[model samples]
Every structure is written in C-alpha cells, then in structure tokens.
Target: MNTAGEHMISEIVGYISELVPIHVDKTKTELSSIMTKYHVTKVENEDVHPDLTEKIQLFLSSKRLEGLAERTLDGYAMELRIFADHVKKKADNITSADIRVFLGNFPNLKMSTVGKKLFALKSFFGWLAGEELIKRDPTAKLKPPKTEKRLPKALTIEELELLRESCKTVRERAFIEVFYATGCRLSEIQKLNVSDINFQSMSCKVIGKGNKEREVYLSFKALFHLKKYLQSRNDDCEALFVTQRKPYRRLTGRGIQREVKNISRNCGLEDKVHVHVLRHTFATLTLNQGADIVAIQEILGHSDPSTTQRYARITEERKREQHKKYLVL
Candidate 1:
C-alpha cells in the first residue's frame, strides 16, 4: 500500500476505535481481513528513480567539497533517502506539492524535527537547481517552521559549587573545570589531545563544526585541576581525557556524557545537566562578567554572531532580575 492509503486506513481505524470500544485484538483481526480482501499490498520494493539518487550523490559530493561535516552529510543522506523512497520520482519531476504532502505525513513529529527534514530537502533541491541538475527547485517556496527562541539554560553559581563538591576523582574535577572554562562542544572536548593545550598561553586549539579551528582559554582553576589530573595519570595515552582503568584509551563523546550525568546525579541537582549546560554556564558567566560578544563568539567558535547573541539576551534578563532584587527605591 502507498503511504497515503496506509495513512487513510490508520485514520479510519483510529476513528472506529475511538467511537466504539472494541476489543483491541478483534479490531486488529478485522483490519487484517479488510486489508486481505482489498488485495492491499505494501509497495516497499519500488525502485527509486535513478535521477534522484544520482542528484543526491552529486549534491553530497558538492557539500563535501564545501566542507560539510561527515555527521551532517550522513544526516542529509538519511533524510534524502527517506524522501526518495517515498516519492520515487525523478529529480526534475518532483513538485512543490509533492514536497508539501511529504512533510504533511509527519504530523506527529516535533516542529524542530520537521524543520530539520525540510532544511535537508531544501538544501538538496537548492543544490540541484544551482548545479542545473534540476530545472526547478521543488522546495524553493517552502519555509521552515518557526522554532521557539528559548534562552540557553545556565547553571547558578551555587549549583556550580555543588557540582564541584560532588567530584570524587581528580579527572572528574578536571573534566568539569575544563568544560566550564573553555565552553567547547562535546565533540571538541572528546577529540582534544594533550598536544592541543598551550600551557604558556593558557589556551588550547579546538576543531569546531565544519572542521574550523579556534583557540579557547582556560582559567587558572581549570589549569590547576587539569595539571593535577595529568600528573595523576600513569598511562601513555595522548588524549587529554582518558578512561580511568589500565589500557586506558581516549574517552568517547558518550563516555564524557555519561560522566557528566553521573556528576549531575551526585550533585543532587533538580534539573538534568549535560555537557552543553556547562557550555551555557561558561557563556552566561563570562558575558555577565563583561566579555565582548564578538570575543565570546571567537572563543566558542560560533560561525554565526546570532548564535552567540542568545547568551547576550540571557545576561540582559539576569541584569534585570538583579536590579529588581537590589533596588532600594
């Protein structure tokens, strides 16, 4: 059965189930009978149009040349594969209406998830049109759904202190301090090498999205703990952070994340804390201390100024709250 037909059947079944409380097993049996009588067979093996696959390959190759990250390329490939499997149409024959219908099928997904899908499609179709692979862009008129601009959540000074006190190991203490000081993303920190640190300059080089390298500063406190952790290590691993056991290896991103969750749990914090929360705390605290937005952007390795501006907004709200609490008038 085609997607549309399957969707229609699902809707009818849902309506019947809601209007009359039938036994769930009986409902499934009856639905199966209906499907069998109608000779409705799922068309899962239809060959995707060669033009579509060819254009997707060309688009991904161009994006690779343009310095897109491998993870980003994989996401594009996954989204495009789903679209191609659904439409099974040539790149040139795909219409905006078809795109709309495709998007409509994902009614239960979050706006952010749907928006990501739309972005991938738009990028693929836009690339095809730009390269003259397709005469017209099917997604030219499509717009992403607006996502809410929530302030980045930062840890309070008290919460930071609590987390610090919760650390049971030198490595854990060092991990928290470095993440809080540098504001590097999880991947950046995971990929960090001991050689990347320049103790003389109190800074380290980190490769951010799109493999762009930038320098992030370490605080005196972070340097103290990091040095202590390194001194405590007996392994020969070059990774800045490594597993505690013998035969130690570079800590994976998930390993770092698991450590963060453990610290959060140990701290008895009400909110779920992650690596990005440490990043937000760094940005919020630094900006509150009068760091320049542009400078913070460079330190955080943000390609877009607007992405760093969210931290500015957070400081503004904090300032207003401080004023309210302190005003004597």
Candidate 2:
C-alpha cells in the first residue's frame, strides 16, 4: 500500500479507538478486516471548525440575555442538541443539506414539531451569521414544513359549568376560576406570588414570557374563590397557590396541570383539557362576548396582533356554525 493509504488507515484506526470502550489492540483484528475492504481518500483543506456545543451555549446565553423564559431556552437547547448529535459536524461545517437530513430523520414527528425544530435552527444560524461566527447561515434559504391551521378548541358554556362543578376542593375551584379569568399561561400562573394580588382592586400582576409584567383582572366569582382558598390555607407560603399538604410548597406548573387534567377527567369532558386549553377558552369566550381583538392581545401579552386574531377567527367560525344551526328563514 502507498504512504497515503497507510496514513488514511492509521487515521481511521485512531477514530475508531476513540469510540470503542475497549482497548484499541483488542479491536484491531476486526478493524483490519473492515479497513482492507474499503479505500479511503483524504480531502484537502479539511479545515477545523469551532465546536458545535460551545456555539450552542453562546446562542442560548444570548437568548437568555434577551429575556427569553427558561422553558423556551430549554426547548431551543434540546432542538440544537438533536441537530448536533445527528450531523456530528462542527458549527461552521453544518450545511443546509445537513439540516434537511436532520429534519427528515425524524419520520414520525408531526409537521408542526418538525417546523419548530426548523425554527430553532433558523434562529441559531441567523445569530451565528450576525455575529460573524459563520460566513453564511445554512438555514437562510430553507422553508419550514407546511403545517395545517387548526381552529382553537374552546369549551362551551355548558361544559365550562360542568368542569366548575367537578372541582373537589376550594383550591381546585379557585384554580379553575383564576385560570379562565386571567387567561394566564401555566408558567405565569405558577410563578404568581401571594403579594401580587390586590383584593380591593380585584386584579393581580403576573410575570409573563420574556419576564414582562402585566396586570390581569379577576372576575367576581374568581375573586370569591381565590380569597376563600387563601383564607382556608394555614401555611405561610408566599405563593398564590400551594400544595394541599404539610411542608407546603408553591404549586409547580406540572402540579397545576395534573390538577386541571383530573378535573377534566372527573367532568367526563371529551377533550383532555389543560391550562393552555383554558387560556384558549378564555380568549375564545371573551372574543365571542364582544371583546376587542387588540384588547385581548394586550391582556394576553401577545406582541403581535395576528396572534390575537386567531381567537377572532374562532369566534367567526362559531358564529357561522350558529347561523347554520339556528338561523331560520
């Protein structure tokens, strides 16, 4: 064999040695057999690129500084990690083709989920280009996979009453009312402090996405239940909601979701409802009852008017359904 062939074989052996848990000598016989069956060519100008993991960390740090919520940061990190693992290439070496293959690898994922992964990649590469970390953004020309626009599913008034009746405790009752009344995100509600509420004003301030603070009003029924729940608790935990047992702690987002799902099951509702469903319900019902789209947008802390317009679209659909069902000549 020529010097170039020997050099390529030695590089392959070294690479395999790094991957195997056992010693290199033990695998050499099997490695030799595989090496003899294939020829290797060394590519020129195979430049070393910056580490993918390090670049991802920098991207996440930049996002954190921009006030993205921890959950959102976590999601971005996960998607990027998946990309790094699949491509096994450094940040600068990643190409649009690599991204396309990475996305196509998950054949079972929905288009919506694939779109989200694509979005994360786009954002990361866009940042790298802006910071001069990469000469070009790989995702600049890639289009996200098309996804269907499904209408938001909001509970009917009768279903809402049924869910209210299914509450097994004052805390549950308060949670249902407050969630619907404020239309707060699950994280926003979980982070609420007891001091954030003002009984006299019938409102409370919540820290929302991007750490932005917003005031949301409580309905009379919500206030009545919330005040009752607070009064009923003996523990001095400062959170607006607490676990029902001793050594009381602030209710976590998962805990809140579990409670809501339990209530949903108890009511025999067809839809498996969670906090986000309640948020949609709140927006849909409010829009149906004559609330302005822009007003709901502000209340929901939506930066874009188009996001709020979804609920308006839901209301319009419902109006058409009602007209078809009940309107008579």
Candidate 3:
C-alpha cells in the first residue's frame, strides 16, 4: 500500500482497530482515482479543502478523539445530512435565525427532537468555523430547549431492588449490572465481545461515540453477573450478550433497550428504563458515592469534562457536599 492509502484505511480505532489490519492494498492508480474522485486535496497543514458535504463527511470519517460506537456515527451522519440539506438549500451562513426558523416551521418536532437537531447543527457549524469556511458559528448563541431540569430519571434505590427481584433472569441481570456498573452505552454493550472484558481487572473496554476507546470499570456485582452470563453462553457466539429467542443470537442495542423496558415493566416501575437512563443512574450513583467528576468523565469516555459535568449538574449531591464543608472545615 502507498503511504496515504495505508494511513487512511488502517488507522481505524475501536474494536475494529483490535481486529485484522485494514485492507488498504489498493493500487497506486486506484488510490489516485479515489483521491481524484473525492477531490481530496491536502492543505499545507494536515487539513483538506473538501466541499460542504465532503467536509462534514471527512470530519466524521477522520478518527474521533473520543471513540464511539458505529451506530452513533450513523446517527450523527443522519443528523448531519438533515442539517446539511437544510443549510445548503437556504444558502450558507445559516444563522441562528435560520435554525430557529427551520425548526419552528417544522412544528411537528418535539423540543427534545429540536434539541438534538440543534446539537447536530452546533457540531456541524463548529467544524465549519474551524475550517474558516464560515464567518461565525451560528450556533454560538443558540440554546437547547429549556426542558425541565428534572433529576435524570433513575431507578430509585427500592426500584433498583425491584429490578433485582424482577431481573432474576440471566440476561436481565447482565443488562442491569453492566449498565449500572460500567455506564457503557447500549451500542457499546451490544457490540462488546467477550474479549473486551478483562475479568481479572473488572474492566470492560468500550468504543464510545466517534470511535474513541476507554476502559469502564465493572463493580464486583456487575462482574459476577458478567461471568455468569458468559458461563451460560454457547461457544458458537462471541458477543457478551445474546438473545433467548430461538436460533439464539447476539443481542442488538435495540434488544438491550427492549430488555430494559421489559425489566422495568415487570418490576412495576412506571417510567421507562432504557440503557441510557441506566447509564445515567450509574454516573449519578457513582457521584453520590463520592467518585470524582473528572474520574467519572474518564470512565464514561467523555471528551470534555463539561459534558460529564452535565450529569453532575443535574444532581444535588455535589452542591450539598459543598455546603456541608463550608459549615465546618
């Protein structure tokens, strides 16, 4: 493989990174054709002057600083395409006014959905601004909807106990413990191969959004459940979690989500308990247990402390802890 070809294809990070090396053995002419077809040109610096669509594609394609699961990348791609078409059709410099107008025009969108679309715009514009393609970051003054800052919906101590009682089945326990303990995303958990778990260290390696990788620690309880789940597994499958549905197979992210809801319902919890909420529960529970916010960021594979701090902000334990210290020491 030529230099650029080898560099571009083989450098993927994630569970895939741990696998066989990339098949970048394209002929020099083939590589040249690809570079030409894409109109990819290297700037003086380590940058490319790709078009709006290609730029976003490149931004997504290039390695992520904080790894993420592939499904997340797909979602980001979908969101970006939506935003790209929106902005491009209306003409660029797609200001905050444009964003608000576009969203407002689409009255069918819920605020949460609006917020997600806005976030995708923010990421898109931020990248454009980085390349000096845009004069200003239109999303600079943009605000996500002021949805109620309710404490992240979580399984209460008792509800968790109920989940324990109701989640007696093997897969249920595995789902609960793994999410509550490691805080890995549903996609990450679903994509997890048994090889990723280091039982001796009680750590599970996760590939997070953007193809970033991090090691999430498993509690003793979670580790035990994982071991048990593995023991019950057939050697034919390599996935850490699998389904009981006939012709049993590796579970998908949706599978885990459905299981979370089933477990939540059977335990009599009215609220839905998706994998993310369980992950949120893990973060908040760890914080309440006095884990450092920065440490939690690492465990959760968040690139920015501010992102991890969102989980902390939604909770009172951090503030209450601060108040008590002022009273004495």
Candidate 3 structure quality by residue, lDDT tens digits, 1-329: 34554454334332343675643444434555665444322223322222556767766765244454456567778887766665553224467887887778667867788888888778777877777767788788988986655566666567677787788687689888888888887777888888888988888788777676788888899888878878887666777887886677788778778888888888677475677888888887777767899999988888888777767643476677778888765
Task: Assess every candidate by TM-score.
Answer: 0.81, 0.82, 0.68
lDDT of 1 at 87: 94
Q: In candidate 3, how many Å is residue 123 off?
A: 3.1
Screening candidate 3 with a backbone cut-off below 3 angstroms (N, C-alpha, C), the clashing residue pairs are: 66-212, 67-208, 67-211, 67-212, 68-208, 68-209, 68-211, 68-212, 69-208
Candidate 3, residue 211: how far the Cα is off, in Å = 2.1
What are the per-residue Cα lDDT tens digits for candidate 1 across 110-207? 88999999999999988888888889898989989988868899998899999999999999999999999999999999999998999999999998
What is the C-alpha local distance difference test score of each model? Answer: 0.88, 0.86, 0.72
Per-candidate RMSD vs. true structure?
A: 12.7, 9.4, 14.9
lDDT of 2 by residue, 59-117 (tens): 99999999999999999999988777677677888899999988989899999999999
Question: In model 3, which runs have C-alpha deviations exceeding 4 angstroms?
Answer: 1-69, 80-98, 129-147, 313-326
Error of 3 at 294 (Å): 2.3
Off by over 4 Å in 2: 1-50, 314-329
**Better structure of 1 and 2 per TM-score:** 2
Model 2, residue 119: distance off in Å is 0.6
Give, for candidate 1, the lowest lDDT window spanning 10 residues. Answer: 36-45
Clashing pairs in 2: none
